[model samples]
Target: MKDSLIQSTDSAYSYPLLIKNLLQAPLVSAPDQEIVYRGDRRFSYREFAERVRRLASALTSLGVKAGDTVAVMDWDSHRYLECFFAVPMIGAVLHTINVRLSPEQILYTIDHAEDDVLLLNSEFLPILDQIRGRIDTVKDYVLLHDDGPVPDSHLTFSGEYESLLAAASTDYLFPDFDENTRATTFYTTGTTGFPKGVYFSHRQLVLHTLGVLAALSTPAVQGRLHRDDVYMPITPMFHVHAWGLPYIATTMGLKQVYPGRYMPDHLLELIDREKVTFSHCVPTILHMLLKSPLSRTIDLSRWKVIIGGAVMTRALCLEAMQLGIDLFTGYGMSETCPILTLAHLKPEMLDESPEVQADIRCKTGLPLPLVDLRVVSDGMENVSRDGRSTGEIVVRAPWLTQGYLKDHKNSEKLWEGGYLHTNDVATIDHQGYVKITDRTKDVIKVAGEWLSSLELEDILLHHPAVGEVAVIGQPDEKWGERPLALVVPKAGATAPVTEKAILLHMRGYADKGLISKQVVLLRVRFVEAIDKTSVGKINKVALREKYLA
Candidate 1:
């Protein structure tokens, strides 16, 4: 009997859900599909797989071993995609360093992750130079650049990226390991003290990829992602694995375009030149793309965009729809593998009026597959799903980070009551749709009444003249705080837009019982631009420091 059991165990293959397995389908189905970068360099999936193997060989040669963390600082590119697979395939953790962080913050993250190797683009060399001495954990550096010879730098390097790949073997065999092994790590772009590190395992990532793929692929006619769709991510690769969509795209073997460093006009050119179809970005990026003068020249009618990393306003959704572009909202955070819900319109609602559709498209959206999402009160009881009662958004998913890296206290707080706290105040309807009202910190209180800054911003965005807006809470003597609005008027707005006009627009909604009449205490200002976070989110922390402090 013991011999029979041992024979059965040896005969059955126990397949582990490692990051390397994501490439299997793509390799067979679309081996020749082109992965383009910057409308310049291009390679087929057949060659891309070779590059992944070569990269693994290179890293292994440079002393990278299982469990070592390999950090990379680069813009969106094919090389980064190779790093995405190769590092994790070899059982090493990939730390996607956010290059936008301050020099001091960057140093802190490197040390915190204990990164063993660094893959850096030449453009950000100056940043490393400023804090290189302080980055004690990194043992070797690999440089990446677009053209010309490598520039002279003081820091010693292992080798240039392309050179290393060219010299390495393309026949490296990747061994399988436990699925719970750490796969990736990166710090959050928090406005608080220090950016906290977050991590995911091989098992969590595989499940997240499958869950998101199922969600994107099942949408009937609205927001489906198929093998034929051309994938481009406007979201930074260093940001939460570019919301973990690259893995999905690769798994489906979709043609992908990676714009190196984002330039609005250049991005428009790439979309037009490459015939790109599906993409995702923060609201700021989408706004910038619309604002580009080249927007009028390009044919954007074929594009489908997923807006995330921030709340997308109704005005922006309307504008995109008017241009015949399909736009929707995706909701998640840096701690949750960065995707939870997508606001894909149901087929029945596709026949609705454009205005009504815009309202639906701008919602935070329904939770994705395997996402156990809830809005709960202080005691952890689920809130009523009447769409009017609001509470904190909590979630339990297969891929949520177990905890903040090295942060035990905050991790305990994040996972209190067996759910990850999102710190977002929101409501859910009977249809299981989540509509976020505001960040708990950003909510305004007046006369002992609560107000949602996001709701106020959404209302003001309906104004014809308001191009972009941010609402924040300002301290008040009579009330704890009142909402303040900073508006950016569109170039050549059809009608005159002023503080009074904006106030009247919001007040109309308040009078209709859509919002709190406490907005009567609201104030407005016209600013050239609003401050943004390192990852292009509206920097409420900076705004509060500048205006309210």
Candidate 2:
């Protein structure tokens, strides 16, 4: 390669790609845009910037400085949005604690991340009390309350959130730093072991924000996000920066609504009251909302939702479309700054039948800009671009995390060939669409042939009485391993679901050549519910242990 280095004048400004720089255009273009909380409280982007400065001053008074770790444990709210910008803008790494995690994992993550200052919501006070003495790194605490004054708790707060913000000056300036400095870190909610920390730099987050904004704001028929669109996030802000949409929203100066805690009816009411136009979430949350009685009475025609964290079932997609809701899929994980692909329908495909559209929508998606996604074999060679053939997904992207924090051994495994290994098995078709068939550990090998558990689950979801389903591998004396499915029947199913009934349903698909004939050996179990991870993904590792062990 030719040497491309160039020199600049001595006085030239090397503008770094810092998170604070993302504010410049929005402050001018949309200074008056509103950021609302739970459909009621509201503030302008002008005030938001001032609050960010005030927060920086407050955190500094509490001894937070450049390179310190500031942790937050709160639900999705305007307060979380302030932290998203303020904490990083002041040259500190923000750790968004996954409050849904078990108390033990919560403690482990807090200590593991070496949190220096913790700003906590009152609802999480009990949890803090449970492990107050055990925490080692948190030197100061700030209370965050929504309804009233801070309640009684064992942990002492250095100050309350709003009080500090109101008392501080808006003149506190954020200093420039290296764009590669770590901006955010959060733990992955894996099913097997203690969560591993993933960190992203200021450069990575800015790039992710711009890339996702470019993808979502681009011209499209159904799911494009525009300035006129009102945005809400069903995904928690703590999880991968709410898949990094908050930053993108702030960058574009879009009207934002934060639903503090995810409650179905409450979300529906907010959607109706605020006329929410764009949002994203996991499949489980969407399913719960569609099942709610209030959702039936509301007008969802103006809404568009992007589904991730788990596969979006064809049934759910069709149901949303019938209600005039524009729903699609997005793909990524905590380590990737959480945006890799989106399943927006192509222009021509927009005129196709609803069934064909849902078929496309349920596929993983087309990779986002700057995302080099591939399905490769064990040797790191690319697999054929045929929809039928499957291999592991490996990718190269500007925003992908360099490695797991403080863990040397597993980090190398994650980037074995300089490409981040996703451990997900997928296939890319001629049109460049990527469809994940199954996780490497989740794929079932039956009768010497590999079978996709995701495929089995998607097919079973079509059953009239089936509500939710997960497929796992079970040992069979003859075949070595067979597919066993756990099914959750619809709430008001007219007919009781039996093992034989579901097995017969699987046989129907096998007969149609839609699946492997080995599905003939499938077994079924009815359950009240499927187990999920902390972030609401199906926990197959737990399922295999519970059902097979």
Candidate 3:
């Protein structure tokens, strides 16, 4: 009976049927609702749906078939949003190629993905021009342009975005798709040896969308996902599918504001003009906004933000709270559908003091419903939730990728024992709050003791002069390993030479006393907003290679 029930559950509630139903829903329900671009160009759901159908039609005409990969290389724009739905809705896999990577890496992904067609924003033409010869499997280049002469390239199919839609039929039929059919493929930014791909099934994506929606609106967590809510995704679309916001907006009928090129001033303008109620971005973006000149001109009280991609500092969180922004944090990874836990208040604590609420908001958060999170020590022993003992975080969820595309070895590592290993070392309290202590790769080992780089970095960042800091382990014959601090001084500030000055600040903490004995503060040579991944993580792997390796 149990076996039969499990089989029955898998057969019902899939991605293909959901899209058909969503398409039939009231297009004009949010018809006047705008997906703003560049503070000017906009598209409502009704108009957006029409364009999506046309694009689907155009893609089919060009021989795009089910199971083929379609690559989109661009910033956040209306065109990118359309491709997010149209590509998958039509049964082709949408590969959001990371634009921040090197031209060679970009070309490698296109070739590895075996992209059937490449859709690019006109601005990327220069880089594409150099790599166009390297992408062997790509047969067509569909230009997604706003206003400019068509870029000249060897590939023939070049035309304005609107023209292609105008010529194509909006009546193309969307095929019935299986929930297990791969809908999207995004490469891991940490692809060192050879890039590995994680594909999302339609069912997984739909579930993720619903989970994200629930996480945002549950009064305990209070996300800005209400019907009247307007959102601006400061996170790039290529990263974790912009943390699944665009799709969530589609399903929830949100009025979205897209900031092209990610200029600080432009983001502020959009937030003010569109009256945006919600957004998700990294802590660095919040830092920039707090320091940006445009910040003084706009009213931030209307906004609520979810900070991720890195640890959110208490200083920044308090600062945002002072500005009347409802601040929260979430934890997830590229392999686990990106959102597994969020630092949202529970019903019992909703009426707690602001100080208590803020304290709760500091932790990584409770695991979302349907996501089972556990912290394990020595790979197998589950750690107690006393909030003292730390362990590696592992998760199991319906939305997690089955395995890396074509690489069974690492894929096996990713899903060992049916749980996705996060590689993030954290501790959980009795209240179910998770506080990350260190990354498995970033932990500093000294005299058989493990010191958290994340903990050290957090402490150093509190220093007024410290702009950014990364703690890495360096070989030490006496201690076995020692902590090497790479410090990025605050803008227009100089780094201090004495280790005493650094230790003076962290003197009281017991961890600091141990760390102080082995801490070596090294002035960072190149520190311009430390290189981040597409998802806004401080790319510690890259930093370790540059500094420690």
Candidate 4:
């Protein structure tokens, strides 16, 4: 009986077979459901599927051979969502470029991926003009806007998206390829250096989608999402394949909605008008939405938001809870098909107090099934689940990146000892909830002992006058390094701050032996505001470059 159970689990986890079955399922299952944009333009599942078919045919006709790379640069639009399926259906890998990247880095990724064709929004014409000569491998350019003329450039441009759709046969056949054939490739938003490319296979995408749905998340079980649920992922399709929700949403027959260009006001209007039930993005985006003026007028109580890409603080979680929105925190990276852990409460925690449940829901939740997650210190030794011992988190999963594209040195660093080593240092509780302390790279080793800059930053934020804080290690010959805090004060605060006062606050923490005694506040600089990633987490990489570079 035990053997049979193991075998059944293995069979159910197969990726290729699952994807094939999903693609073949009836399209009418998501009937009357819509993918909306700008509150007015939208497409039903019938029309959406037709567009995807047309896209597939267009790419194949443009000599997009199986295993070739197809790159996309656009906002979260219905057109970008179509490429999520169309490119892979023809066995070619889809590479979603981060439009937020610098022109030079964008060129590096396009050149590194050896993209065969590029699909871009006409809005990026200025940036494209700067790097047109650098990308030599791209054979065709497919422009994806209906209202504008193609931007003039020296490159070999082909046709507009609408024109291609008209020229190609929508009934062009989708060829069957091995499940392991690379389906998508995306560059990680590297904090320090040029972005690193990560690729995923069809099997991996299928498995991730199934696990995302089958998991005991509130939207899956509590929301009663059938084949008819409407999903509008506010997360950009270019980032980690929008955490793979675009594919899963469509395959599950869920009506999808995309907020074109991702204006917060537009997204809010779509949610209210389209009656969107499901969406996902980083915590900061939600923070903006909750604080945005539009949020006051829009109806948001019915939306189910999946927050990931960074840790969720108690304050942020409570704010969402107050709105009666079903917000759950998730954890993953670009390398692991990006779905490592979810903060959904376990069945055993169902009877626990609301506070206790909320704590678990804020930590990195239990690992998805088949994901072997562990926290280890210097060695591969597992840390105690007593919620105190924090260590580097590592994972082993089938869908992890093969390696950084063309960068073997970092790729090997990514998979040390046959496991994907996540630099995130964290602690797990008795119930298996993990809380991240800091990244291993971000940790400061003063006098050969660890000091958490995150902890220091968190404590500094408690100051009545401080609004935001970031702490980074600076070079020191004596202790090897020292910590410095960068703060952004709250608007219109009368209480002035100084380096001495900030360090005095730390003295109490240091005297109690909570922080390093060797820690010294070298300097303090007040800025207009701290910068952040597109997803809203503090951009420490930029800070390091500006201060420590």
Give per-model TM-scores: 0.97, 0.99, 0.92, 0.88
lDDT of 4: 0.78
Measured by TM-score, how close is model 1 to the native structure?
0.97
Arrange candidates by TM-score, descending. Answer: 2, 1, 3, 4
lDDT of 4 by residue, 1-549 (tens): 456443466547443542434554547466456777656677877787788889888888889988899999988888888888788888888999989888998998899999999998888878888886778789998887746466676655688897888787778676566888888898988767788889888888888877776663343343234555568887788899898877777777776777777677777887887788888888768866876688877777777777888776655666676676767778899899888887775557657765665666677777887789999978889999999899989998877888988889999998998889999999998888888888887887778877777777766765667766787888878878777678887665788877777778778877898777766533567766777875567887788888887
**Which scores greater on lDDT, model 2 or model 3?**
2
lDDT of 3 at 135: 72
Candidate 4 C-alpha error for residue 427, in Å: 1.0
Write one digit per residue (lDDT tens) for candidate 2, span 1-549: 899889999999999999999988889999999999988799999999999999999999988999999999999999999999999999999999999998889999989999999999999998988887999999999988989676788888899899999999889988898999999999999687899999999999999999999999885667899989899999999899999999998999899999999999999999999989999999999999999999889999999999999988888899889999999999999989999999988999999999999999999999999999989988888888988788899999999999999999989999997999999999999999999999998888887899999989988998889999999999888998899989999879999888888888889889999899999888889899999998899998899999998
- At residue 467, what lDDT does model 3 achieve? 79
Better-scoring candidate (lDDT), 1 or 3:
1
lDDT of each: 0.92, 0.92, 0.80, 0.78
Clashes of 3: 1
lDDT of 3 at 180: 79
lDDT of 1 by residue, 303-384 (tens): 9999998999888898889888899999999999989999988889999999999888999998999999999998888899
Better model by lDDT, 1 or 4?
A: 1
What is candidate 4's TM-score against the reference? 0.88
